[model samples]
Target: MVRVGIPRALLFYQYFPMWHAFFRALGAEVVTTPATTRATLAAGAARVVAETCLPVKIYCGHVLDLVGKADVVFVPSLRSLERDAHHCAKLLGLPDLVRAVVPEAPDVLDVDVDLEKGTLAFYRAIYAVGRRFTWNPLRVKRAAAIAWAAHLRYLDWLQRGAGEAEHDSETGWLNDWHRGLTNVAPLPITIAVVGHAYNLFDAYACHDVLRRLASLGVAVRTPTELPASATRAAIARLVGRAYWACEAELIGAAGCFLDDPAVDALVAVIAFGCAPDSVMMDVVQRYARATGKPVLMLPIDEHTGTAGVATRLEAFVDLLTRR
Candidate 1:
């Protein structure tokens, strides 16, 4: 059996189940780089220049970790997931970037996913990737169908407020959210967290911030719980239109939180060096201030200390509780 490695950074958080199902349907054994760690971040940073963003650095680390463990690594270049708007440049050229830095990385199976060309282009790209593993187009199509089903189930899971059920330790809060449906006292504080999914959910990347909030018995709301219509309305009202596809997670979520009476405050997590986020976060902050919502902007980088993030989160929650 051929082992195919998929990094746990970037698109992994967004589309991992689909990726896993598609590859497995093709009969490829799949392995993923474990959760981010100091060592993972260090290995990734060593391969890239200092200017690269932390998420991209961690991606490089994941690819490096897969060097000897897999026959090929799946690294797709996603130019756009929606029309007109596009992904960050780093994500668009990720295959080349990872290959350039992580020279020891195993052979890579890459495909271009540009929805601007049309939604069909997205499906065709996955088919192209499946072809590398097997010649049977029929098998590829079946894999696509199975992958689609998995994607839908994953979305439904997200809507329930529990993140991926796959992890129990670090994401226990994610797994525990359903108990709220059963009947539980609401936490005193309800905070809305807005950021790139990678930065928000990647435990090590954000120093397990959400789990920390959960440990405090705080009820946390995230972009995953938002409705598409609300995000679109927020985009329309905030900036006329979204400059980046992922703005729904940041600007849209923040916009919704500002209007929501239940949410006590807003937290924005952004990685340093992401130009779009820096600019968009500025807009969010200005709007948040005008609306009287206490907002905390946490900037992370390779040198970000765990203690620092913990202290800041504690302080932010403290401020919210006192109000």
Candidate 2:
């Protein structure tokens, strides 16, 4: 049985179930890198150029961790997920980038996923990846169908607030959120943390920011909780289409929170060296200033300290509670 290594960073958080299901259906053992850690980040940073973003550095570290443990690593080249919306250049060339940085790692299976080119282009890409394990096209189709279904289910879960379920990591109790369809008793304050799915949900990356907010007796809302229609509606408020697809979602979520009276504050998590996020932050800050809503622009990098983030968050919450 050949083992396939999947990194926990980047696309893994977005499409883990789909990728896991697809690979499992093809009879391959799928192995995932553990959550990011200081050591992992260090390893990644050492291998990549200093100018690369933190997330990309973390991704390289994850691939390094998979070295000698798997037969091949799956690093797809994602150009665009939607029409007229492209991914960051780093993500588009991820597979090649990894190979260049980590030559000792096992073979990397690179697949191109550019939906803007047309559905058939995407299908052919999937077929190319699937053919590696089996020659049967029908088998690949079945696997793809199952993967798609699981992907939809995962999206539905996140959109419906189901992903807010019990988080078992540190501060789990604080982050456990309401279960069994129970509503949270009106908290004194409600905050919306807006960012990409990977950064917002990954406990290691953001140091469990959501859980920390919950611990402070504050209600927390995230972009994943918003439905597709709501995101689109939020995007409409902007003057033009966002260049990066994920940035659009973040921008849209920020707009939604700004317009909602129930949302007392907004925290925009900005990744260092990400150009789109840099631009998005400017827009969000400008909007926040115009609306007179308290907004915190939290910028994170490889050297970001958890204590610092917590201190800032504490101060922000303290000020809000005093009002």
Candidate 3:
């Protein structure tokens, strides 16, 4: 059986279940890199050029960790899900970038998806891979369908979990809700965290910052849990200047927290050298200052150390408490 390695960085947070289901159904062994740590960050930083953003550098580090452990490594090339609505250029260039950096890298399977072109484009790409490996297009299609269904189920579960948490928060039963669902104790301070979906959820790459914050009695909220439409409305009212796409959502979430007295502080996590995030961080700081809400900007990269992040977080929390 062939061993397939999946890096626990980037989109792994969003599409992992689908990837796992599809590959495992094809009878391939899957190996995932361990959670991100100082060592992993250092290894990744050492492998990539200094100019590369933190996210991509860390992704390279993850690829390196799985180099000899698998027969193939899956590095997807996502151009745009919608027409003229592309992802960060860094994401579109990941596969080629990794290949360039690690000549001895394992066989890379490039999965390209353009949602603007239509769903069939996606199916065809996967089908091509299926034919290359298993020689059975029918089986591949079936497996893909199964994987898609499983992915939907996982999303539904996340929504349900978030809904329940909100309900508990409303009723002042947050402690019970946190214990029953997440098994983590609630923090005395509530923090609003803003970042890309991948960075927000990838425990390893973000150094498990959410968990660390929770352990220190801090309740963390992401834009996913915040109401998008309302946040957009708030952003327009607060900033006057509208934000675009992910930036809009992030700004909206920050705006919502800034207006609400219950949210004690704001934490904006951005990848080092991310152009969009760089712009967003400036806006977030400007907004925070105007609103008189404490905001911490955390820039993460392949070489980011957890100790530094933890100390900063602790200081931020202390600042919030004092204020």
Candidate 4:
């Protein structure tokens, strides 16, 4: 049986289920790199140039882990989802970048999904991938559909679980499913978590910080969970200049969270070598200074030890509690 390796980074959060199901349906064994670790980060940083972004460096590390373990490594080239809605340029060049860094890399697959061209164009990319594995279009379609359905269900489950936890806590059901999932007992402190989409959601890579924070009696809010319209309105309310779309969303969410007395502070998590995030973090620091709210900036790299992270987290929480 053919073996395929999928790096558990970047869009892995958004597409892992679908990718796993499709490959499994094709009778291929899929091996995923273990969650982001100090060793993995070091491997990636060693392989890439010093100037590469932190996320990219981490991705290279994952690819290196799969070098001799799989027949092919899937590195997608996602340009845009629609006209003007595009991913960072670095992400679109990932396939080539990985190849350049690792000359002997397993056959890296390039799948481009440019939705600005047309919705049908995205589907064609999917079909093309299916063709690469087998000639049977029917089987491909079935596998893709099954994978998509499973992915949707999983997302729904997460959302439902979050909601139920909130509801159960409100009703004083402390011994229920909600209680075991989070440390939201008594009065939970609200915390704003900011970062790129991929880094924020990957539990292993981010050291499961959100769950850890919850266990420490903190409730977490992500930018993705904020209402789009509300965030836009808040962005427009900015006193002076405009902000980047992603930064604006984060700032708006922070503003909203800060307005509520229940929220204690904000936590900004950025990958070690992320260029965009480095700039954003500077902006966020300035924002925090102006607003007089305590902001903790945590930079993550492969060599990051959870014990150190937990120590920092405890210090931050202690500061929040005092305030």
Whichever of 3 and 4 has more TM-score, that candidate is: 3
lDDT of 2 by residue, 138-171 (tens): 9999999998997787777666666455344321
Q: Identify the candidate with maximal lDDT.
A: 1
Residue-wise lDDT of candidate 4 within 1-323, one digit each (tens)?
77888997887765676688877876678778776777777888898778676678778888988989999999998776535545666887899898898888799878897877886777788888877778887888887888788666545544444345334211222113233443344554678777765676666567766667777777766665555555566545542333343544455666565555666788877787765566656656776777788888778766677898788888888877887
Error of 3 at 149 (Å): 1.7
Backbone Cα, N, C clashes tallied per candidate: 0, 0, 3, 4
Off by over 4 Å in 3: 162-188, 201-207, 224-249, 252-262, 286-292, 302-307
**Which ten contiguous residues of candidate 4 have the minimum total lDDT?**
168-177
Sort every candidate by lDDT, greatest first: 1, 2, 3, 4
Q: For candidate 3, what is the TM-score?
A: 0.79
> In model 1, what lDDT does residue 209 have?
70
Please state every model's RMSD to the true fold in angstroms: 2.9, 3.2, 5.6, 5.8
lDDT (C-alpha, whole model) for all candidates: 0.83, 0.82, 0.73, 0.69
Query: What's the TM-score of every candidate structure?
Result: 0.92, 0.92, 0.79, 0.77
Q: For residues 75-129, what per-residue lDDT tens digits would candidate 1 score against the true structure?
A: 9888876777788889888999977888888997899988889878777887889
lDDT for 31 in candidate 3 is 79
Model 1 earns a TM-score of 0.92
